[model samples]
Target: MNSELKTDRVFLEIFKNRVQAIVEEMANVVLRTGFTAFVKETGDFGTYLLSPQGETFGCPLDTGYNLSLGIPAGDVISSIGQWNEGDIVICNDPYSTGGMATHLPDVYLLKPFFYEGQIIAFGLCFIHSSDVGGKVPGSVSPSSYDIYQEGLRLAPVKLYEAGVLNEAILRIFLDNCRIPDQNWGDLRALMAALNRGERRLQELVERYGISRVESGIEDVLVYAETRVRQMIEDIPDGEYEFWDYIEKGPGGYPVRLRCKMVVRGDGIFLDFKGTDPQVRASFNIPTLNKQGHYYLVPALIRYFRTLDPSIPWNSGMVRMITNDAPSGTLLNPEAPAAIGARAATFIRLMDVLTGTLSQAQENKLPAAGAGQAAIVMLAMTDPVTGGRKVGVVQPICGGSGARPMKDGIDGMDFAVGHLRNIPAETVEADMPILIERYGLLPDSAGAGTYRGGCGIDLQLKVLSPDTVLTARNMERMEFQPWGRLGGKAGAYGTAVKNLGQPSEERTGRIDELLLQPGDTVSFFSQGGGGYGSPYKRSPQAVARDVRNGLVSKDAAYEQYGVVFHESKVDLDATQKRRSAVYGSTDEQQSFHFGSAREQFESIWSDEMQLAIGAALTVYPLALRDYLKRCAMKEIDDRFHRGEQVQAIEVAEIMAAIHRTIAAL
Candidate 1:
């Protein structure tokens, strides 16, 4: 290599490593001094270093999910005035923060990194605080009607001036939050962490010069962009469409999510044009640009890692893809749209994207994983102490979908991985809830030759009255995570409790369910779909899984066509059954859940939900949620008004059309 070129490459690598190490130290600084358990123990925080031009250059990989928050950080910087060196801008407004802090609980701060009287880079950090004062104690709920109901929304304001902490702003924060002491502690920790990040960054500039740091940022992004483009180039370019549904919304109607991608060479355009419009509840996505970042980054990261993990996360990875989601769709909602549970929609978006990419390049992508194992907190006030106690008693998740050559990993965290379930002992000690049961649900995994992962089962009994539970980004209650090949579908999810009688199958939202000492609640999460035909599965493997309680013997017989006799495998009978059911391996039987798919199919189609959701997006929350549930009244009221019929009527029409066509 040429001497000049070699020098530049060496300098770039050194600069990149230095900046990354600085961000790593920044997170450590926050956790060490933070007051809240969420930040100190759970480590629910992130640190990033941004370029001068409002671009995310680097971030700590281990902390936070990915670089999606980078967009919000840049937004914070640009929205604020000409920021000074010591001015630290803080905001948690989903709208004002440019979707950086997705919800209120997450506190985001942006500080300009300066060198010799000029702004060079920005240091950013965000932590999910334990409480922010809302309708619920934790400031999150699936049924939240408005952002105000969620919690305090902070605009971009300097929490610090001339390196002096702004006590007034600090006091205002502590005054509103339920846990004032912990909130103050976490705020100080965030400021301290940013200072550490800034200090380390300055040291790097001193060592390698600012010019080298700038060049390294460009080089790292260029390298990542090239690898991602090459990966996209290998696939046969064409337009592909994939659509999925969410079973648990305001009215429990399936919300249709459609994505049509046009891929030509190294470029791709993702259009959610025909997708359903926004809903009234917390499922709506708040920021357009942020939503785009959230969808593209994770998918590219997953795909690129399959090729090489050495690729740095920068704009280059997502440079090849463009998003075209309209303002009113579920993916991009208007103002006042409740977005606390939007992560659930993102999970389906990732799944739909993966499914689409798989069709284009089968070998490049992994099968669908447990979509989103979201954390649902049930918090209440202690009657005696008058203090708040929160418990993440059940963080529900499904099994990962089966892979090409291997079974899916059980209880996987697909979108973000930093979420760790709080220990039962910690909850009992800190709160009044009793964790009765927390374990994997057997026979819940999708059945195939390579089985999907199994989801978790949780049972909690509330010991205090007036407890509030906020369940966000939770789905798979109706449409289960799908499988590839001939894999059987996994079990659907459920959330119920003991009401008047001991057990009654009840469904729907109970935001403020009054509970006595004996009242018990149970939540069963969904599982991932399997891959390949079950008949082709090895009899020995099935037996082992059955023995381990991962797979039941009945599931083996029903899904895999494998039978065991008195604890031992009936090899002869199993072979005979496999041959009779599956016949020659060459002839692939397309097993149809005529009843299963039809069950959801009868309610709505992708096209209908898109049309209705589009129309409903312009309306207020109550109207949108009403359209989702009591659309029958809407259909009957407007059948002849020349306006388009609702989804319920459309489903009925489609069914009638099918009957007519079948008769012909």
Candidate 2:
């Protein structure tokens, strides 16, 4: 592969930059011309340059919509069958393109680049539309159990032929979605990005020959694969295991995601053998059982880039990695399975993969960050048009986990921080809303030698009546972000209505709620986890936190072993508190999962979950939900009766399920 290219290292480096510039220009065009808040403000979209073989060769330099490197172009590119000059195809259904379009909201379009009547490359781009015709106004709802309930599903079909617009397809789409004009504006922006990529790529072909351009694409992929494999070698070769859970499954049970990572020589294998089967909820990830699907390899992507930033940012980075997630699992769900809320599961997958890497790296990695990112939206009556208007409020995310050498970032974690936030002024101007509070939550940081970043707080008051609100990806409320190496766990998140008023009520993990005029709502993000022991943290650091309003003086004395006198640390009092409070703490403790997960795991351990999942597998997918709930109810009753229920087997559980269903 190396010798066939004939392109030297020096020339390849320059060639890589030139190709990357084309993609960056494409992205810039989309940002400037987009209509929806998701594209214009949140930047929930991307552009990529793909070879005829469907490998991503060029992508944006930064991590904004960093999905360009991981998303496959082959399925979508080939789904249209044949491509002609001045032709474009589009698809929004995940099942049609084989996971190419993750969800219906993420619409994909591709334009093939032709040289002398032969295809040489392709340009692809996508936008997360605000509405795509679903049961709800925004096209996404937590209650959706099937794909049909989510939104309109577009199969691989041509939206343009011979440079002429196919108005029929466009009309069908616009008629279904609530926001037709805005969706049309975003679609035009994507077209602009694709055309720009095609033109810039043409200039590259003219500068270098066509053969060199084709060879350059293949060579760069090889280059990235080699570099990624070398980084994988840094981790000691071994089988490392890790697992985490999603808050709600098909029947609202906590679904577990387990992985066994085997690193050998220059390759890494991710074995998701113990993962739970697909449920009837929106948490399923449509991976299509593809090897090293982009959704499955984010931890590897982050780790490689963190160690060596120069690795080529393309699909080649995942060339040497392999995935073994069984079909029907949460990571590889079948068709008609709801996936509107997969973004929440996407964050969890990254956290779970990072957990496996932490074990392989000997706990050198940073502790867990807030693994959840909430997309808050509001729907109100439009004053001018007298129709329903929906707009995004904010993409609220928490802080980064504390690193071994440095403190975590505040009020924004790295998981989805690349996506921008909506400004308060923008929200107020777009809808009848008032921003009450938009800042970090105090005392939300995890305590350790290096403190984790604090969580985010957003409070808004509705000025109009009949206002409805929806918050997606709200998690870490029950299970806190875990601390590492004897550190204290981060604070949990919460949502409340009419805060500070007589009507104050806690709304934990809400799907949708109605708001009256002048009613206020507050939402929070889970704080990041810390690294190392809190007793080892410097008193000066604790005092600084108190002064900054991030950590209160009382919390400093209680959580951290720090004492203060008149806004200053008292060394003698601090020493006494350290010995009296944290002296019994186990410094060797590798993780602090807070009381929620610890207490829950005591009864519903890994063995218990595996038994339940395995027993339910034999039954049909449709009946598994009812059977699982029944089996769990028996365990629940037995455990509550102080029966120490470890003696149950799959056969016994099945028998109990039958009895429960028969009685019903």
The lDDT values for all models are 0.70, 0.84
Quote the lDDT for 123 in model 2: 90
On TM-score, the candidate that comes out on top is 2
- Give each prediction's root-mean-square deviation over alpha carbons: 5.6, 1.7
What TM-score, over all chains together, does every model reach? 0.88, 0.97
Q: Compose the digit string of candidate 2's lDDT tens values, residues 1-664.
A: 4664568888789888888888888988999999988889988888888888788888786524875566766777766767889998988998888887878999888899988888889898889998898887678887788999988889988899979999999999999998899999999999999888888888888888899988788888888888888788888999988888788655556777899999999999999988887777788889887777878887778788888888778888988888898878888888788999888888888878888888888566888888887888888996667877887888889988888888888988767867888889988888888999999999888988999999998899997788888888888888888888888888988999999999999998868889988899998787889889899999998898899999998889888979888878999999998988776997668778899888878888888887887777777777766787677777877789988777357558777677677699
Determine the C-alpha RMSD for candidate 2 after optimal superposition of all C-alphas: 1.7
Off by more than 4 A, model 1: 1-7, 67-72, 290-292, 383-386, 498-510, 583-597, 607-664
Off by over 4 Å in 2: 1-5, 659-664
Error of 1 at 386 (Å): 4.7
